[model samples]
Every structure is written in structure tokens, then in C-alpha cells.
Target: MDDQTRLELEAAAFRRLQKHLMEDRTDVQNIDMMNLAGFCRNCLGRWYQEAAAERGIEMSKDEGREAFYGMPYADWKANYQTDSTPEQQSAFKESFAKNVENQTP
Candidate 1:
């Protein structure tokens, strides 16, 4: 594939992942995702912000989150976030260090 095609394919895959996490599987908690997979919606948003920074887009954390979630982060939390269980929280705590090490807040 050409460079343009590869980019388009990657972008499409990203959009699909975003839709899966944000729209289709809203029940999946971010903490649980981080514990299990070492990343979550926040990480995705962070990556988005970093990518924008790479190209001089100057996106904020909140702005990147809003773009990914299709609403304000506060609103998304209010509507969809559930309290994490102790087990999940503990796992997340362990996972957090490694995950955050290579990413922005």
C-alpha cells in the first residue's frame, strides 16, 4: 500500500476503536481496561493530544478527550463512569506506573 492508503487505514482503525470503546462498550470501565490492557480512554485521549502536538495542533487534554468522547469529559464521567471495585483499582494502581511512564497526563 502507498503511504496515503496506510494512513487512511490506520485512521479508520482508530475511529473504529474509538467507537467501540466510547459508543458500543460504554459498560467497560477505564480502570478495568487499564488493569487488563495497560491503556484506556484517557490513554487514547493522551495519544491523540500527543499526535496533535507532533503536527503543531496544540490540543489540550480536555480538548482531546472531548474530541474522542464526543462530549465533555465531565459529562461522560457523570453519565457513564462507574465506581471501580477494590480489585480493579489495585490492579490499575500497579499498571498505572508503567502506562504513564511513556505517555503524557
Candidate 2:
């Protein structure tokens, strides 16, 4: 595939992933996802922020978060986030570095 075609394909795949996360995967908690898979909605927000910066757009972190979460991030956290257990927190801290390594730009 040519460069444009490849970028288009990648963008499509990213949209599908975002759609699935927003619509199909409500049961997954951010902390649990962080512990197990390494990243969560907030990570996507940060990536969005970075992307905007790369393109010379000065987007705030909260704006990027709103774009990813579909509303203000504080609202999403109030509605969706639960109190994580001690064990979960411990595991998350321990696994954070490995998880960060796995995330793609």
C-alpha cells in the first residue's frame, strides 16, 4: 500500500477501536484496564494531546480528554470511575512501566 493508503487504513482502525471502547466496552474499568492492558481512556486523551501538538495545534490536556471521553473528563470520572481496591492499586503501580512501553503513539 502507498503512504496515504496506509495512513487512511490506520485511521480507520483507530476509529473502530475508539468506537468499540465507547459503545461496546462499558464494563471495563479504567484501573482494571491499566493493570491488565497497560492503558485506558486517559492514555488515549494524552495521545490526542500529543497528536495535536505535533500538528501545531495548542490543545489543552483537558480538551484532548473531552475529545476522547465524549464529555468533560471530570464528568466521565464521576459517572464511570469506581474506587479501586488496594490490591488493584498495587498491581497497577508495579505494572505501569511495562504497560507504558506497550502503548503506540
Candidate 3:
């Protein structure tokens, strides 16, 4: 219930989410996730990078993406990324703006 324990629990849950995305959600592209959930693997990586910096550990965006994706992000994109439809792209743009506004801290 302390701050340290809460952080550990949150980190563990994040790891499980990453594992699920990598292992069970191969069909779900980042674009679709962004359009629907307003966040995706790349966002998760950025968050991971921020968290590492908060602890004074310098982790690159690429390193964070690799940890989340279970492979190099470029490799994952080459192998898994599908072309987004125009509708999906439009929805993503709208959702992205709202998502950003909601996350202002």
C-alpha cells in the first residue's frame, strides 16, 4: 500500500500488458489501437522512457519500444504493420488531439 509497493504493482501490470500485446495481439496494428484507444505501443514506449528517466536511468525510445514489442520496433513494423484506411487515419487524428488535451499534466 506504500508508494514503493504501488509503483512496483503498476510496473508489473505494465509488463503484463506489454506481454499480452506482443504474444496475443499480433493482429492488432498500432494505427487501429491509436484510433480506438487513443494510445498504442509507441505511446507505451514513450511512457517507459519517461519512467526510466524519473529513476535517473537513461533509456532510449528505441530501447523502450524493444522492451514493449519483444523486438526492434522497425522489425515489428516491417513484419506486422498494415496500411491504415483513410477512415482510420481521420479518426486517429481527431482522437489524438483529444487524447493529448486529456493528458495535459
Local accuracy of candidate 3 as per-residue lDDT tens digits, 1-105: 899999999889987898788878888988888888889988888777888888999999899888778789999999888989999889988887887546843
Per-residue accuracy of model 2 over 4-105 as CA lDDT, tens digit each: 999999999988888788778866788888888878888888899999999999999899988888899888778777889999989888777676666556
Deviation of model 1 at 57, angstroms? 1.5
**Alpha-carbon error at 19 in model 2, in Å?**
1.0
Preferred candidate (lDDT higher): 1 or 3: 1
Q: TM-score: which candidate is best?
A: 1
| CA deviation > 4 Å runs, candidate 2 | 97-105
Pairs in clash, predicted candidate 2: none
CA RMSD of each candidate after superposition: 1.7, 2.5, 2.2
By summed lDDT, the worst window of 10 consecutive residues in model 3 runs over: 96-105
Ranking by lDDT: 1, 3, 2
Q: Pick the candidate with the highest lDDT.
A: 1
Tell me the lDDT of model 2 at 84. Answer: 91
lDDT of 1 by residue, 1-105 (tens): 999999999999999999999889999989988988998998888788888999999999999898888899999999999988888878888899878875554
- Backbone clashes per model, in order? 0, 0, 0
The model with the greater lDDT, 1 or 2, is 1
